[model samples]
Target: MKSQNIRLCFNNTVKALFISALLLFNTNLFAEDLEVTGNITQLGNDWLVVQGYTFYVDQNTELRGPNGSIVQFSFYQLNDLVQVKGNNRGDGTYLATRVKLEDVPNNSNEIELTGYVSAKGTNSFDINGTTFLVDANTIFRGRRGNPFSFDMIQVGMLLEVKALLQTNGDFLATRVKAEDDNHQHGNEVEVTGLIESKSTNSIIIGQWEFFVNSQTVILDRNNLLIGFSQLNVGDRVEVKAFKQLDNTFLAVRIKLEDNPQSQIEIKARIENIIGNDITV
Candidate 1:
């Protein structure tokens, strides 16, 4: 009977150790730093909502406006497209360490764009070779006065954008409306979508094919320079390209998106097969 009790105690101790290790593994995931980019949807007394995540700002949090100018927290207004670097409190709230506003054009110099919706980012979209920044104030409409949101927008759909042009050559969209142009021609365009297939010299994004050459530049999600060989199928990418005389897209630059939330790990499965000149 004494030996039975000792065995029970040993089993309970083993279970306790396993539970503690599991808790530590989960804690590490929540302790990692986080960065989010989106439009401010709500402004509370000491907190704000970006996309859907709520973040609180303390006195030590750094704030900056356009042109990298230091600014007070009150300077940020609703619908402002901003990036927040913060730490997760592990309870669905974030403690912001820094907030930086994106460069958006003032209410002047309206420009119009008509092309495919190549890609959609946190609070921005790319159309017709230009990146258009959006905020809550930016209107989104469908054909014939229908309502739409950024989540409804997809790759390969035709869209018309009316925006203000910034001095730095980017655009700040005031309105984005959809268009039905099944027969419209592809012009100089920017596209963002998943890479359906890829080769050493080219890739297919959505319904468009982009060809790369020596002059084509490749960048990672952080805008760091990389090589074409680093790309793979199923990667989400954005491409700036020009339509050539032969109707083929000549890629000028390609940017790969490295979203931390999308990070995943997998194990490779080895297949037993023999090639023409080798055996496995």
Candidate 2:
């Protein structure tokens, strides 16, 4: 748990949302669940062999499937759903304790996050059966946004979390800060000049400033598409990016977006002028 000093939002990060929906739809089609186990006998380049089974895992995956499967543990594979109790083998696979191919809890591993008091999400965010209000003062640590939205966060996304992990297992982020283009994740940076243009993949963050995904720092690329695609030129914004080794994101999801030249629509027509009310 870290201090709840920093916070970020969807409009401010470059997180790639986990496409759980895609996985769910595909997995649900499996007829009969299956499970198997064997000692992790062979470890090879980009692949693992347990008993006589073979599987692959991402280079960055913490442990193939969890349950403390660390370096060189025997492993198991599940057909439709998989659950394991074991150790990691450092080779992107896990040794097993209790291997089963049963339906994973629909909402067990899924966690609902809430920042501190100022950044509650009760107005928009909810979990299993709980809700909380959110504001700039709240925090959402760990990137857990939605993948499909392009504005949501996801796993492996870095974030400035602002709450302690309660003994009961609840994420209480007081503030959330998405990492930036340079993998830096704090404070505000000055991106000056007029936005040259705006498009889906490319956005003119500032005059002569053409920001593309790979060029800028970000947490991940999940929900960033939403934030990036909806950007408006001339809309001056201040943000911070978080970076690790090769990633970045906006610090405070977009603390301010000042677009003086854009039209403000009050209803059916685009108004040339608008008052303090964005929509009334």
Q: Against the unseen true structure, what C-alpha lDDT does each candidate score?
A: 0.64, 0.33
What's model 2's lDDT at 204?
50
Predicted candidate 1 versus true structure: per-residue lDDT over 138-197, tens digit per residue: 899988878888777765556777777667766688888887643212233555666879
Tell me the tens digit of each residue's lDDT in model 2 across 217-241.
2222233223454455565544333
Report the alpha-carbon TM-score of model 2 versus the true structure: 0.28
Q: Candidate 1: which pairs clash?
A: 118-192
- Alpha carbon deviation, residue 159, candidate 2 (Å): 8.6
Model 2: worst 10 consecutive residues (lDDT sum): 17-26
